[model samples]
Target: MTDLTIRARIREASNATFLADLDGEAVVYKPVEGERPLWDFPDGTLAGREVAAFLVSEAFGWSVVPPTWLGDGPFGPGMVQRWQDIDPEQDAVDIVAPDVAEAPDSGWLPVLEAIDEHEQPVTLVHEDTEQLRRMAVFDTVVNNADRKGGHVLAMPDGHRYGVDHGLTFHVEHKLRTVLWGWIGEPLTPDELEGVDRVSEALRGDLGRALEEHLTPQEIDTLGARCAALRAVGIFPPPPGHGPAVPWPLF
Candidate 1:
């Protein structure tokens, strides 16, 4: 890999994230040294988790996650992913006024209704598309703990990519996201096949690849999650014990 030249710090990110130029191409780097220790996750593991998520995405062959890998950066060893050119006019997920959300051809499905800072009612919604639906399924397989609207990148060609996957692959049922519009809906035949691919790969090369990033227990639980999803064959409901969506939905 080409040496990364730091361009700017992404200050809005919770961890030390940087915009870098890799051989004239832009990329995002999240160094392990800058990761804030989480109460539940072990220190220095977040970078590995990011790579692990990418690996799982590849196993599913959905291109849901961008090309990601571990590399040395200005800050040190970290997770590095190719930057995506997002479309400013597109949003795979969004928050809209209730009236707009209720339009017959809005092309969005409501996930949650809430009050904004102006004391106005708004609805959390996502595009009703097979692309976004695949992402929702991908999130479930990875046990994504935070799937904020901003993490979803909408490309000009209509492809959707998911980023910020550090808080994922937990053994616990910590699934949380704004992509709950398909709750209880049966998985399409293609979706089921995707899940089956992950499950089969887990028992072979994919599981072995993940050992570099996740613990044996975490990998096992990931496989279990895949098997369960395949057996149930539906988008799961939000967990009862915790907030179903991440704070600051975007």
Candidate 2:
């Protein structure tokens, strides 16, 4: 774990999470407190996600959202991550409730339906589809096995960024996400430009740069994914197995 200074414990919840102003800034914290590890979630396999955070952060020039290892979580060693306000009170838009997907009461299964029910304001100025594509590229680059809708966090500013990278850098081709709005749509010229840049960058120096964060198999998969996207373009058909999207994406 990277070195850190604990400023304060923000709150105590089921996850025993807190907010630390590490190095003089506010960051979200989810500390391990008990033996009940967050073993319920399918992926987001902790250690692997930290590496995924590194790779994705480097791939896109966006702020990387990762958990900081403060100590043991409720079950074992825990981590604190960057905190982002999904909805700011100053804004007229209620990023929660009406817009945000309701939590599944029965369990996590209804999360998908709730996510589908939540309405995302499609304005002329903001284009969510474009944002999803960039994230899709990042997902492919990291070989994120679980690219669920809950992972995709829409910021107040309109940037659609993804989180939860524990199940990343897999050797297999497991790039599942909920942003299939552009499945049949062609990659826009601007979007293609970014893809082209990444494609060229992944060949030599950039690929080498990511070497430390990714394993041999992971790196090879990244290169292959890039080639595949270039040849077939970004959109592809859905998977054959379980829910391709994350459950209860709010």
Write candidate 1's Cα lDDT for 56-132 as tens digits.
99999899999999999878899999999999999899889998889999999999998989998999999999989
User: Would you list the C-alpha lDDT of every candidate in the order shown?
Assistant: 0.93, 0.52
TM-score of each: 0.98, 0.62
The best candidate in terms of lDDT: 1
Q: Model 2, 37: alpha-carbon shift in Å? A: 10
Please write out the lDDT profile of model 2 over residues 1-250, one tens digit for every residue.
3444455564433334455555566665554342134533343345435544554455555443443333433234555566666643222111233223334441111112322234543211112445666666666666665665455666777665566565666665566565544555566666566556666767766677656455666667766766776677656656566556543322
Off by over 4 Å in 1: none
Q: Model 1: clashing residue pairs?
A: none
What is the Cα-based lDDT of residue 59 in candidate 2?
51
